[model samples]
Target: MLEGKPICGGVRVARDEPIRYVCADCGHMTTTRTGRCPSCGAWGTLESEASSAPSKRSVAARVVSAVDVRPPRRLSTGIGELDRVLGGGLVPGGVVLIGGQPGIGKSTLLLQAAGRVAGTGASVLYISGEESEAQVALRAARLGVASDRLLLCCGTDLEGALQNLWDVSFVVLDSVQAMRAEGEAGWPGTPNQVRAVAQRVVDAARAGDVPAVLVGHITKDGRLAGPMLLEHMVDAVLTFSGEGYSSYRMLRAVKNRYGSTDELGVFEMREDGLIPVEDKSGLYWNRSDAAVSGVAMTIALEGTTPLAAEIQTLAGPTVFPYPRRTARGIELNRFQLLTAVIEKRCGLPCSGHDLYMNVAGGLSIQDPSADLAACAALASALRDVPLPGGSCWLGEVGLAGEVRPVTRLGVRLREAARLGFSRAVVSSRERNERVEGLEIVAVSHLNQALAAGLSRKEA
Candidate 1:
C-alpha cells in the first residue's frame, strides 16, 4: 500500500543489517546487539564481523600408506627433575606448557634451563612479556646465568620474536598470557588472544623444529589462566604445585603425547635456583634410633622411583559427641575409611577418639599401598604401642580388612631395603623372593599386619 494513500506525505526509513557479534572472552558466537557479552558477561568484548562465508560443498584429501617411525630425539633441559617430568627431555618441534601460581618460580626454572642449554653452545631465546629487559637481566645476573649464547627479548611482540625463532635452538616464552597476536581483537590474556598467541607460537615452534616451553599463569582456582584450548594445543602440559613459601615444588605431567604421564619431578628451591631431589625417599623420612608409636614408614612409587614417606597418626580420647578426624597430605575420606576398618576389623576403639594423620615432609601421597602403613600407624597410636624398628609397610587394606597385594611390590621393598628398612609388612600373596638383607613379613589380614608390624607389649 502506498504511504500517501490516506495520510500526509511520508518517506521510507532505512535500517542497518545486523552484524555478527563474537565474544572475545569465551569465543561465544551470536547475532545479539547487546553491549555486554551474553556468554561470559564481559562488557564491550563482543567483536563485530561480516557474515560467515558460505560453507564449502566439498573438500579434497590425500591418502597415504602408514609407515613405521622412530621416536623423536629429545633435547635435555639439563635439569634432571624437569627432564624426568617431561619423560626424559623435550622433543624437537614439541610445545610444552608449564603452569603455576604467581611467584612460584616458573620464570626462574625456565631461565635456569635456558642458561644451561646455552652453556652447551646451543642458542636459546628468553622471551619475556611480563618483565622488561633490564629486570630480566638483573635477575639473570643474580642467578649467575652467564651463558653467551642466551638471547633475551622483551615485550609482547610475538610476531617479531617468531621472526628469529629459527635462529635459536630453543625458545622459552616467559608466559603465554602476556603475549598477543598482531591482529587479535581482544587484549592480551583474553581467551581469543591467548588462543591465537598459543596457536601461532606452537606453529612457529613446530615449523622451525625448535623445542618451546611456555610458562602459563594459574587462575585462583589453580587451573591454567587461559582458554582451555591452550592446553589442548600443546604437546605436553606440566603443572607445578607446592606451597608458595615452601622450598619444595612438585612438577607433574598432566598430558604427554610422547611419554607416560605418571612420571613426576621433585625440586627444592635454593639460592641458586630449582635443584632436583636425587634421594626422594630421604626427603620425607627422619631416621631415629628408637622405635616410635604412631609413626610408620611406607614406600610410594612415582613412575619408577620409590619414595619413602612417614605416616604418623595420633589418636586421643575425644569429648565431642562426634569424634574428630583430621588428615594432612592424604585424603580425609580415605583416612576415615581406614579408621572404620581398624575399629571394626581389629576391635580398636578409634570411633571414640580424635584422630589426626599426617604424611611427613608435606608431600601428598596417592598410592594405595600406603594403606597398610596408615593402618599400622593408627593402631599404634590407639594402642599406645611402638611399631618394630627398621620396618616399613607396603600393602593395600581392603574393606574386608584383608591385606591386598599392590603393584611393584618388589620395587618398593628394594627401595625400603636401600633406605635401611630391614622388615616390610606386605600382603600374604606377595612373592617370597629372598632379598639379601630385607625380610618380608607377609600377613593376610589387617590384625596380622598390625601384629607383625607392631612389637608386642613388654611382659
Candidate 2:
C-alpha cells in the first residue's frame, strides 16, 4: 500500500524503524507480523528478533557422559613456511581471513596452497569472485597447478558458489568484496553484504566440516576492508605485507585462535610462485667480503625463529640549518632516541650531523634488541671506522645510556654462533649468560659497547 516494499503482509515499515522479525529459514528482515516471508515465501518461519531484549524462552541443559578430548588434526598447506605461520596447518571447519595490499600476492599464495592441498588427494574448491576462470586457470598453469582435484568456481553470487561447495575438503574464497549474498539489500562490498556473505560461507563450511580461506582487501591505511566483526567471526587473521618495490613478503598472524600470534613466515616472489625462505638470516645479513664501516650485525627474534640483520648508518655534516634524521626499516622515534643517547652519554655529537639509518635487506626490525647494534652503527659511521668482523650486538639502550639486557639472549646468541659469529656484545647486567660457540663481550653502557664494537682508533 506504500511506495516502499511491504515488510510483512502489506505492512509498510518506515525506513528509520527497527526490524522486529527475521525469517529463520531465509534470514530476511521485516518489521511487521507475517506468517510467510516476503523474500523466501516460507510459512510460519518468521521469528521474532529483538536487538536489545533477552529471550523469554525456557532454557534446557543436557548432561554429557564423556567428552572427546582428541586434538583437531591440521591439514598442511604443502608449504612448510605457510604451514609454520598457520600454527602447523589448517584446521577443519576453521575460517581464515587474509588481508594485504593490492599486488601483494595474497591470491597467488592462496592458489599455491590450494594446489598443494589438492595434490594430497583432497578436493579443493577455489571460488574466484574477482578474476575469471580463464585468468585463474592461466595463473594456475604458470604456477604448475595441474591437480584435477582443485575445482574452480568463478562468480559473484554467494548462493551460486555454494552450490559447487559439496564434497570439497578445502574452500578458498578469493575476495569477499566482489561477492554478494542472495536476498541482501546492500550492494556488494558494503558492510551488510560482506557480513552476510561471510556468515553464509562460514556456516556452510562449518556444517560440512571444511576449512575455508577468505581473501579480504585492505583499506588505504592498511586495515581489513570490512566490518570489525568480520575479523571476530573468523578463527584466524593473517596479514601478507611487504614493500611494493621489494620482492620480500612477510606473512604474520595478527590473531589466531588455534596457534601463537608470535610466529612469522617469510617468502620471496619468483617467476613460478612464492618460495619460502628457509635461510632467513641469509636474506637479511649482507655477506661482505671485507668488513665495512658504518655497518653492524644484530640477531633479532621473530616469534621463535632468530634472524640476523645488518644495520647500516651514515652520519655527515648537514648542509641545511637544521640537522636531518632519516630511518628505513627502523622506527624514526627509536632512531631519534638512540641518537640522543649517543650525544648525551656516548660523548658523540650527532646534533649537527645528518644521520641516516637502515636495516639491511628490507627486513623491518621492531625488536628493541637491535637497539645496541643501531647505536653501534651510528657511532661507527660518525667515526668512519669499521666494526670487527664475526661479531653481533644484542642489547637495548636506555635514556641513561645503560645497555639493557634483552630477552632470549641465549637464543639470539646461539643463532649468531650458528651463523659463524665469533663474539657477542651483550649487557653486563646479564647474570652468568654465556653461549658455547661465541665469546660474550659484556658491556654496561653505550660508550663501552661502542668501544667493544668499533675498531681501535674510534674507541
Candidate 2 lDDT over 405-458, as tens digits, reads 999887887798899999999999987777787899999998888877764544
Model 1: CA > 4 A from native: 1-66, 455-459
| TM, every model | 0.88, 0.84
TM-score of 2: 0.84
Error of 2 at 257 (Å): 1.6
Tell me the TM-score of model 1.
0.88
Per residue, candidate 1 scores C-alpha lDDT tens digits across 135-180 of 9888888788767798988999899988878679899998899988
Best by TM-score: 1
**Could you tell me which residue pairs clash in candidate 2?**
none
Report lDDT (CA) for all predictions: 0.86, 0.88
Query: What is the lDDT for 305 in model 1?
Result: 82
